[model samples]
Target: MPNIKSAIKRVKVNAKANVANSQAKSAMRTTVKKAENAIAANAENVQELVQSAHKALDKAASKGLIHKNAAARKKSRLAKKA
Candidate 1:
């Protein structure tokens, strides 16, 4: 435990941020997976799913949740897979 008041506050803030970042990352992964599944199943709405996945990846990248290169790489792979 942080004994200093500011340290304690910082710890709390970091904890909250961790939770938020984890949720965002999880949602992004789910979006990407949905796109992949649509590809595998040859779903009619695959385009829409891929678009959604791209949006999610871009959003996460812009938010600094993931590296821009990582996002770009994933988007490229998704496009190739489609």
Candidate 2:
């Protein structure tokens, strides 16, 4: 539906970026969930799970997929739960 050539190119780039962003977000959520579940189940490896979650959050933040404060908050909460 884009009338200009640049607009058409923008649309294509936006679609690709959207998919990449979505995948990163999904992975971040999954890592957080795994950490939470480990805590809830009273797993002995909670520390490892927390570390994994923190790594994922840091990576997401570094990639500009999430705010640094948001990532810090999540890491703090996960650490507290563990």
Provide the TM-score for each candidate, comma-separated: 0.98, 0.94
Q: Compose the digit string of candidate 1's lDDT tens values, residues 1-82.
A: 9899999999999999999999999999999999999999999999999999999999999999999999999999999999
Clashing pairs in 2: none
Scored by CA lDDT, what does every candidate get? 0.99, 0.94
Candidate 2 has what TM-score?
0.94
Task: Name the top TM-score candidate.
Answer: 1
lDDT of 2 by residue, 1-82 (tens): 7999999999999999999999999999998999899999999988888898999999999999999999999999898888
Q: Which stretches of candidate 1 lie over 4 Å from their true place?
A: none
Instruction: Give the lDDT of residue 18 in candidate 2.
Output: 97
Error of 1 at 75 (Å): 0.2
